[model samples]
Every structure is written in C-alpha cells, then in structure tokens.
Target: MTWLVTGGAGYIGSHVVRAFEDVGLDVVVIDDLSSGHREFVPGAVPFVHGDLLDTGLVEGTIREHGVTGVVHVAGFKYAGVSVSRPLHTYEQNVTATVSLLRAMAANDVDKLVFSSSAAVYGTPRTDLVTEDSPVAPESPYGESKLVGEWLLRDMQRAAGLQYTALRYFNVVGSGTPELCDTSPHNLFPLVISALVEGRTPTINGDDYDTPDGTCVRDYVHVSDLAVSHVAAARRLAAGEPLAPVYNLGSGTGLSVREIMDAMVRGTGIDFQPEVRARRPGDPDRIVASGGLAAQDLDWAMRHTVDQMVRSAWEARRASRD
Candidate 1:
C-alpha cells in the first residue's frame, strides 16, 4: 500500500508527500536531487535519490517497496526555459515519462497520478478553459505534458493501467511552515525575492488586453492542490473508474497586478514593480473551470490570494530566521 512520489523533494511534490503521510499512508520518495532538495522528504519516509528515466532503477524501486501507485511529478516545469531548451525539455518531460511508463508496466504498478499544467491550454481563444478545451501548448513544456497525457490514455487503452492527470493552474503559496518554494521560475517567489532584496518585481507586460493590463491566471494554493492529489490517489485505489484527466484549479482568475497588491498587503511592503514587455509564450489570461476536479475529486480551493501571499511571506520569513 505504498505510493512512490517522484520528485517528492520538490516544492509541490514535497507538499503532496506530506499530505499523503498525514493520512497515514506509507510513502516512498524518488528524486534526482537536480532541482529538488534531499532534505525536503520527511525523516519517516524512505527516500530514493535517482532518475526516473533509469528503467532499472524505477522498476527496482517500485518492486522493492511493493508500490501500488506513482505520483509522477518529476521533470522540467519552467515554461520559459522549455522554449529555449526544447530538446532537454522533451528528454526530461516526454522521454522520462515514457521510460517511467515502461517501468510501471514491468513492475505491475497499474495506477498513476500525473502532474500536468495549465500551460497545456496555450493562449486560449477564451478566458475560461475546461478539461475538454482544445490543447494548443505554446511551449515545449506544455506540449510534453499534453503528450504525456496522450501516452497515458493509449497505455490505459492497451494495458489495464488507470491514471488521472491533474492540469494545474498557477500553483502558489506554501503547504506547511517548513516547505516554501525556493524556485526562481515561479511568479510569486520571483516577486517576493525581488521585493525582499530591495529590487522591483518586474512585470512582464503592462499592455495586455485584460483588466490591469497584465496577464491573469488562476492561483491555487499548494496545500489545496496537494489535497486533491491525495483524494485522487485514494479514489483510484478504491477501484474507481479512471477518467484520465481533471483540472485542479480555482475557477476564479487573478491578474498579475492583483497578486502584487495581495503580496504587498500581506507582507506589509510597498514596492513599485518595473514594467516590461511580455515574455515570448505567455498567455494573456488563462483561467480554468475546474468543474471536473470539483465534481470528481470533491476538491475545492480554500485559500484566497491573501492567504497564498501570507503563507509565502511566512515561509520566506521562516527561511531567514
């Protein structure tokens, strides 16, 4: 009854690991420690430091632990980087997933919960996207995830593998007081770092066609997202029929300027942000319906924008303490 959490040492993965452990489940973590920290895994859980692309290692770990399911969270996630490093992104996200699939097949690990992203939607023709929305990924990162879902669907059709791919939108905030996102790619931490370091948080574009003239995204707290994964895993273990996809996000949208306002108010810091041009592949606005996750997983985001800000601020403060 153990679950293997790939990239469990990462910001989001660590949170999911904590959530699973809190529910009294046996958890084993496999991380390459490339971007993830080894210290993030709880001392109580067994941690394996390795690459998921290694079929032998992946199968061996699953077989050794009697793992029944895997939460595939490892890979390159930065949308901007994925554009520049398309080959590397493909190798990490797509190739690695294929290798993982092979390993799961060999080990008889029939269930998986994949961490997909809203980037798969690209610049939507509309503001709100549903699970059935047309996937026009602008960058390689999104393409890789969409491809992963495709692979999972095919594999499920051929094999008996059951899976649920959760397409996340703007995962922000901290789950616990100890685990804050240290990644430089995310908008929340990037802004917080800039402000904390006495520099301006750079705004990508000021002239977007949305309110506040900046990009708008749905921000889901990390804890709520983690809880959704837990629920998805439990439901799959209960022999629930697999739908193969769900969007884990809040239906509400928040503009970049609105997030900045929340960060300032939550941290009691008033700092001006530098206006800049738009990044190459950024969508003007990407909000989700999240109706599928709400109905299927029975999950809802409880934390507001202010709560996200406060949690990140507290984690940052704790880091410095």
Candidate 2:
C-alpha cells in the first residue's frame, strides 16, 4: 500500500521516508518546507509542497498518490518556544491534525502512523515512563500532540480509523549527511553548532541530582526511530493490531555530562561544557520503557552514545562544507 508522509522533507521525516523506501513500499511526500529542506527529499519521489491547513490540497494529494496510509509528522515541534507561541503551536499541531484527519476520512484513507512526542508525559513523577503513564503535558506543543491522539481515537470510533501514535523522546544523530537536525531548540544541534563555531557548549544546569549532577534524558538515534515508524506502518498495512501508543525510548538514559563527553570524543574537541542555571520546569530525568515497542514495532537502540555523536558530527560537518 502507498503511504503519504507529511513533513517528509524534514530531518526525521526524510529518514522515515527512506526507511519506507528501503522496505520496498510505495511512498509520497507532503511538506510545507517551513522547517524542512526541499533538498532532503529525493529527486524521484513525488513531492507535494503544501501545508496540511489546506484541506483540499491534502485530500487531493492523498487521492492522486493513491495513498492508503499517512505518516503524520508535520507540526510545530518546539516545546520551549510553544510556551510563548501557544496559538501558533495549536494551529500547526492541533488544527492541522484535524484538517488532515478530515481529509483522510473523506478519501477513505483509514490507516495512520502519528509521530507523537514524549512531551505528553511532561515531568513524570517516575524516571521510567510506561505507555500507561499519566499524560500531563506542560507545553502547548505537548498538549497539541495529546489532542492529536484524542482526535485519532475519536475518529477510530466514528470512522474506523486505524492508527498508532509513537511517542519519542530526545531524537538526535543523523541517518545521512544530507539530512541533519536543523532545529534551533534541540540540544544536540545547539551543542554541535557551538563546537563547530569554536564556542563552548553550555549545559543548562549541572546541580541536578543525577549521577553527573545534570538532567538525564533518553536520546535515540534518528535512524533507529525511523525503523520503528516503518514497522508500525507495515503492521497497520498488514491489518495487524497495534497499541494505541508506544514509547520509542532507550529504557535507560544518559546525563548531559555523558553526552558532552561523547561529543568531545567524537569531535576530538577538548573542552568542558559551561554550566548554567537550570531552565524553568526542567526535569531531573525522563526516560521510558520501550518494551512494548520492542515487541511490536522492532524498536531498539542500535547506536551507542559515541556512535550517535559521531554520526551527527559527521553529518553536521559535511553540511558546512
């Protein structure tokens, strides 16, 4: 079955598109290019440069491409910035999702794989989050994502929409040199860009109660995350059952200090990260159990911390040249 991948020109979306191709599945792309690069999409793939807000364009693309499934990845993804730009975030994430769902229903595209976020958990009381963990989204971005999932559930009851939302934590590294993370607010890009420019990467806080006195997070390689997305799509296409949500996490986590060390080793840059005061609402640690995903979606942490850093550095460096 053919799939329409929204935001397919973005870093993670590009990788997910490639994964679908690697599995010999027919795929098409729909991206607005606001935060995506047209160059990331292959020359051969049919690309529709448009936004999900335009319901007609979205429905037309699905019908023209014979898309039976959709990988919904396009949205406002910045969590910290969403606090200030709540309306913009809701418009992009929540409203866009509703529009896309309407288009899918109108076109009889019943299958979907939603790219959700671990932000829905906010600052979980427990370190290891499970699929059943309470969802208390702290930012507009997260809240929008939760609403997107709700819409899918409601659609399932109303229109027989078969869907699965993969909640991801800190996604980093690169699947290819042509597609590297360009998010201004992501930690890896921020740190790597600083080092590339001969500046010290500053840690947000160093006095947390973690092993290295810094916040701990689940950092997964982009390629690994993409694999799970494809698996989810395949399961849905094959008419197999899937959980409502799955956490694509590392189970364990790494501290910021640990990542800094990996970056030093990966880039051969000998420097200490400058420690700064904790950002407001920063959690000490947030990791999740990927056991459910591992069973159904073929989820696994295939890259080590060093590998993650090295791949990301290579791609970032190549982008500069």
Candidate 3:
C-alpha cells in the first residue's frame, strides 16, 4: 500500500520517508519546498512540488498514486516567528490541514499520522509533560498545531478517520549526513553553525530555576522520531486502536549548559559559550514523557546526547562543503 508523506523532503520528514523505505513501504511526497529541499527526496519516490492548500492537487495525487494513508508532516513550524506572523502561521498550519483532511475524506483514505509539536503545551507547569498535559499554546504556530489535532479528532467522528499525532520535543541529529536539520531557528544547528563559523556559541539567561541556570528541554534524535512516525502510520493503516495524541520525547531532559558541553565534546570546539539575556517566552524547562509512545510505537532514544550532537555536527559540516 502506498502512503503519501506531506513535506517529505524536509529534515525530519526526510527521515520519516527513509524509515518507511527501510520497511519496504512505497511512498510519495508533496512539498512546496518553502522550507523543504527538493533534493532531500529520493529520486525513486514520486515528488509533487506543491503546497497542501491546494485541495485539488492533494486529492489528485492521492487518487493517482492510490494512496492508502498519509503521514502529515507539512506545516509552518517557527514558533517565534509565528508571533509576528500569526495569520501566515494559521493559514499554513491550520487551513492547509483542513484542505488535507478534505482530500483524504474524498479519496476514502481514512488513516493518517500527524507531525505535532511540543509547543502545543506552551510553558507547562509540570517538569515532565504528557499527552494529558494542558495545551495552552503561546504562539500562533503552536495554536495552529493544536487546532490541527482537533481537526483530526473531529474528522474521526465525522468520517471514521483513524489518526494519531506525535507531539515530540526538540528533534535533533541526522540519520545520514544528507538529512541534517537546516532550520535556522533550531538550537542544534545554531550551535553547530556557530562553532563551524569560528564564533562562540551563546547561552541565554543562566539564572533560570533549572539546575545549571539554563533551560531544560527534551531532545530526541530525528531518526528515532521517524521510527515512531512509521510505527504510528502502520498502526493506523492496520485499523488498530490508537490514542489521538502521543508525546515522542525523552522524559529526562538536558539543560542548555549540558547541550553546550555536548557540542564542545562533539565538535572539539574549545571556546566558552557566551551568556546573554534570555529571549522572551523562554521557560526554565519543558520535557515531555514518552512513556505512552514507547509502549505503543516502539519509541526509544536510540542515540545518546553525544551521538546526537556529533551526528548533527557532522551533517551540518557536510552540507557546508
């Protein structure tokens, strides 16, 4: 059965596409290349360079390829930028999802795996977050994602659609050097890029309540996250009962200082990180528990912090060359 992977040429989406390939599942991709690189998609996989807002295109691709399911990874994911560009974020992340849901229903493709984000939790009061955590999204991007999940829930009732949303924390690392995270807003790439460019990495606000005076966050390897996506898609395709949402995260998290240290070890960069004023909306910590995902989706942290940093560093270095 063929599955359509929306935005499959992006960083994490590329890894998800590879995961499905590794399992011998045929797949197709439709990405506008807004933030995704067209070259990241394998030549053998059919690639449609288009946005999800075009319901007709989505439906056409699904019908042409005989798509049986979808792994929805396309969206506007910059939480900070979404604050100033709320409408764009909602249109990309929310309106497009409505179009996708409509296309799926028309094609009778009832199964889906949604790529959700930890931002949906906003600044959680609890040290460890779960699927049941309150969703008080602080940015338009997050609000849009939460809304996407709601659409899936309602679609389930309206059309008997089966779906699952994986709300993962900071996705890092690379399955291969060609598939590194290229987001300018992501922390791993920012640090690795700084060191590569002969600049000292900076840490914002060291006076946070967390130990080590830095924000703590769960960082899951991108490859491991992809595995869970594939598992969720498989479960949905099989009509197995699944939760509407699952957190793909490391229950325990790393402080900003710890991540900086890992970068030092990973890249052999010796300069001390510059401490700066904390950015607005920065929280002391936001770590989600992946207990539920582990039980159902075969989710696990297959790589260590050092492995994560080293792989990302290597991949970023490779891209520059």
Candidate 3 lDDT score relative to the true structure: 0.93
Candidate 3 vs. true structure, TM-score: 0.99
What do the candidate models score in CA lDDT, each in turn? 0.89, 0.95, 0.93
Candidate 2 segments whose C-alpha is farther than 4 A from its true place = none
What residue pairs clash in candidate 2, if any at all?
none
Candidate number achieving the greatest lDDT relative to the actual structure: 2
Q: Clash number for every model?
A: 0, 0, 0
Tens digit of per-residue lDDT, candidate 1, span 1-321: 999999999999999999998899888999999899887899988999899889899999999999999999998998888889999999999999999999999888889999998888888887788888888998899999999999999899999788999998788899777888988888888988888898888888988888789888889999999998988999889998757788876787999999988988998989777889887767778899878788778679889899999999898878777
Q: List, residue by residue over 1-321, the lDDT tens digit for candidate 2.
A: 899999999999999999999989989999999999999998888999999999999999998989999999999999989999999999999999999999999999999999999999989989899999999999999999999999999999999999999998899999888889999999899999999888999999888989889999999999999999999999999999999999999999999999999999999999999998899889899999999999999999999999999999999998998
TM-score of each: 0.97, 0.99, 0.99
Of candidate 2, the 10-residue stretch with the lowest lDDT total is 174-183
Tens digits of per-residue lDDT, candidate 3, 1-321, equal 999999999998899999999999999999999999998999999999998999999999999999999999999999999999999999999999999999999989999999999999999989999888899999899999999999999999999999999998799999998878889999998998888788888999899998899999999999999999999988887878899999998999999999999998998878789999999888898999999999999999999999999999889888887
lDDT of 3 at 262: 91
Better of 1 and 2 by TM-score: 2
TM-score of 1: 0.97
